[model samples]
Target: MQRGGRVDGATLANLAGRDGGSGWGLKAVRDVHQGHRLITLPSGCHLTYGANDDPRLLALIDKVPSELWGAKLALQLIAQRLQGGESQFASYIAELPKGFPGIPMFFPRTALDMIDYPPCSQQVKKRCKWLYEFSTDVLAKLPGSPEDPFGGVAVDINALGWALAAVSSRAFRTRGPTHPAAMLPLIDMANHTFSPNAEVLPLEGGGGAVGLFARRAIAEGEPLLLSYGKLSNDFLFMDYGFIVEDNPYDTVQLRFDVNLLQAGALVSNVSDALGAPLDLAPRTWQLQLLAELGLVGPAANPELNIGGGGPGAEVLDGRLLAAARVMVARAESEVAGRGVERLCAVDRPLGRDNELAALRTVGGVLAFALSNFVTTLEQDKALLVGQAVAVPQPGGAGERQLQPPASEDEMLAVRFRLEKKKILSRALQRVGALSQAAAGNAELKQTAGSAAAKKGSKPSPATSKGFGSKKP
Candidate 1:
C-alpha cells in the first residue's frame, strides 16, 4: 500500500451480495494458517478524533457535547475531505463511501417509522435531530468567518450525516474505552460476524503498528471477518446499519413496574386469601429484599431484560426474576431471611405455590408485551419472506393484504421486532414448563396430605405448612 500499510495474504475486492452487501471486504489470496499476521498499519495511518490540530476546529469540538463524540470526529473528517489533495490522508478520505444508504439516520420518515422498537427509535430520532440543529445553527454560519473550520467551504446536514455514518460504522477503539476511537483504513473493510475468523491485536513491544491475525486456518478466497462486540440488535442496527439473524446477544427491555406485576398475577389466576384485589404491594421484608437486590428503592435499576446478552446468560435477568418472586410472596415466613442470591437462582424454589405463581406471572408479562406489537409473529415471518398475507384491519373493519418490506430499513425493522418476539416466545415456553413442574409438585404434596388425613395420624411437622426455612 502507498501509506506504509502491509497486506500479506489478503487483497481488497468487491464482495457484493455477501455479508449484508457491505460492498467491499478483504479476501484471502492464499491459504493462511492460524496465528498468521494478515494485515498491519502503523499508528501514523490511523484517523483518530484528536489528531486534527486546527485551533478553530478544536474549539468547535469542545463546544460539541461529550456524548456526541461521533459529531466531533465527523467535523475532523469533513475538514480533511474539504482539503482535497492538501490533506495528508487525502487518499484514505477519498476511499470512504460517498453515501450511507444503510444507516437509519438517512432513512425516510416512512422507513423510519417501520422501526417499531421504542428504545432504538428514540436513539435514531435524537441523533437525527442533533445533526439537523448543529448543521443549521452552528456549521452554516462558519463560512467566511475567522472561526471557520472548513476553510470557507459550506458544510450541510447531508455531508455531516455522511461523515457521522462513516465514523459510526467503521471506527474502532484501538487505544481503550477512555480514549477516542480511530478508523483503521483496510482493517475496517472486514465485514462483521458473531463468529470471527480473524482478530486485531497490537504489534508486540508497543511499536504503534496494529496487526490482524488469523484465528484459525483459512482457505484461499475466504473473506476475513471480525466480531464487533457482543452487541444487541438495538446497537447493531442503529450503529452499524445491519442486523444479525437470531443473534444470541439480543435482548428485550422492560421496566420493572408493580402495576405490570399485579396485572400478571391476576392473569395467572393468583388471588388473595382475604378476597382482596391482587395489589402486589411489597411487604416490608419483601421491600428490603428487593432493595438489596437493586431492583427497588433509592439505588434501584428498574430496567429489566427478557433475553440473554451472551452465551450461558439467563433468559430472564436474575434480579428481575428475584424481585418478581419476592413481590408475589404472601408471608414473611415464605421468603424471610433468604439471601438475594438464592432467590435469584432458578433452581432454588421457595415453595410449589410460590414458584408456580412467579413463573406464571412472568409468562403473563411476556404475553402482555407481545400483544403490543403491530403485527403477529406469523405475519412478520410471512412478510419477511416476501409472502403476501392477509392481516386483520383495525376495529374489525376488514382484512388487508400485507406486502413485503419495501426497503432495507423496513426489512431491518421487521427483522428486529421478529427477533424480539422470538425471544419472548422462547421465554414463555420455558416459564410454562417451570409452571407445570411446580403444579405437579403441588399435586403430589396434596395427595400426600390427603393420605395422611385418612390414616388419622398428624402430618409430619416437616411436611406441614410453613414448616422449615431454606438454608442460606
Candidate 2:
C-alpha cells in the first residue's frame, strides 16, 4: 500500500460510527489545539489522471479526452476495483461507503420526482445518462473486455456509476501532471459542515501534498469536519448527496422575462385607457435600453434570498430594481408623450415621483416571481404538517423504517420556500405603502396647484409646511 506524508503524533485515526455510517471517517485521537496539523497526503499518494500506466488501463484512458478527465479517473477506479484484492487500490476501495444516501443522481426518475428539487434532479438525470453511455459504449468495448483480464469480474455501468459518485463527492482538484482531480486517501475522509472546524491547505513544498489544520480547538474524539466552500443545498445535494440546514448561502434563482416586464408596465401605467390598447413598442424599446445598461439578460439570473434584505441588497437584486425603474418610466413616457432619458440616467437623483414609480414596478416584478412558487410553497407546508409513516415494504419484513413527517430533502425544500415567502411578503408590503404615499403626494400637489391658480400666485408658506408634514 502507498502511504503519504507522516502525520505528527498520530493525532488523527480512522473510526467507524454513526457519524459516517459504514464509511470510515477521520477523528481526533486526542484534544487538538486550533491550527494543529492533523493529516497530510504527499503527492505520491494521490490517485490522479493517467496515474496508472498498465497497457489495458492506458488503452481505456486514451479513449477518454482531457476535458472528461474526471470521468477517466472514475473509470480507472472502477477498473481497479474489478481487480479486487489484487488491485493497488484494494485498501482504499474497501473503505468507501456501501451506498450513498439521498443521491438524486443514483435515484430513478420516480424517486427524483419525490424529492421535488427540479434543478438538481434534472442535472443528475442528464449526467447519469452520459455516465451510463460512457460505461456501456466506450469502456466495456476495450480489449480484454470479454475475459475481464483486469479482474475476474466484468466492469459494468452500475459499477461505473458507484465509482463516479464516490469520485465526485470525495476527490480534490490537484496540481498533478495533468493538474486534474485526484483522490487523496486521508484528506477526502473529512466530512463537510457549514461551520467547518478544520481546513485543507496545499503543502508548502508542492509535492501534491496537502495538510489538514483545525480552524478551532477540537475536543478529543470529535469528527474532523471541513468546509466544501460556501455552497447551497442544491449544489450540496447534486454534488455531495447532503444538505445543510439554515445554509446562509442558500438562494433560489429568479429569472425575469422582458415580456412580463412590458406587460406589467402597461397594467401599471395605462390601465385607465379603456378604449385604446397600449403600444408595446415603447416597452420593447426600453428592454433594449436595459440590455445596453448591462442590467438584464440570460446571464442575469438574479438570486432571491429566502431571508429579508434591502432593495439594492440581497432580497431584490439591485440591477433588477434598476431595470424595473427604467421600464416604469418608459411606461409613463408612452402615456405622457415625454422623453425616457431622465429615468435612464445613472447619476441623476431618484426624486419622489421616480421612487414611487420604481416601488410599484419592482413590487409587481417580485409578485410575479412569487406567484411561480405558490404551488411549491403550499405543498411544502402541507408536507411539514403531515404525519410520518414507519412501515417497511411489504416484501421486506425485517427492514426497519424511519419515515418522518418529511424526508431531509423535503424538510429543506419547505424551509427554503418559507423563507422566500417571507421576503416577498415583506417586499410586497413595502410596495403597497410606498404606492399609497405616492398617491397622497400627488393629491397634495393637485390641491396646492388649484389654490395657487385661484389666487394667481404660488401656494402660501403655511400650506407648503403642511405638505411636508403630512404622514405617509
Q: Give the top-scoring candidate (lDDT).
A: 1
Q: Write the per-residue lDDT of candidate 1 for residues 1-472, one digit (tens) a residue.
A: 6667888998788878565556788888899999999998888787775644888988888777877777777888888888899887898899887877667778888777766666666678788889999999999999999999887889999898999999888888888866777888889989898889999999987856798899999989888999998888777787788878778888887776666665665566555544444456556777788788886787887677777567766687676567777776766666668887888887567777667667767777777677666677888999899987786787989998878898887887788889988988988887887777777774432211000011123222211111111110
lDDT tens digits by residue: candidate 2, 129-235: 77778778875765455423354455677777787788878887766446668887767877887668888888787666788888899887888888877776666
Q: How close is candidate 2 to the true structure, as a TM-score?
A: 0.69
Backbone clashes for every candidate come to 0, 0
| Model 2 poorest 10 in a row by lDDT | 463-472
lDDT of 1: 0.75
Clashing pairs in 2: none
RMSD of each: 8.6, 12.3
Tell me how many residue pairs clash in candidate 1: 0
- Which residue runs of candidate 2 sit more than 4 Å off their true CA positions? 8-25, 51-70, 108-110, 143-153, 176-178, 262-285, 293-313, 331-361, 374-379, 385-472
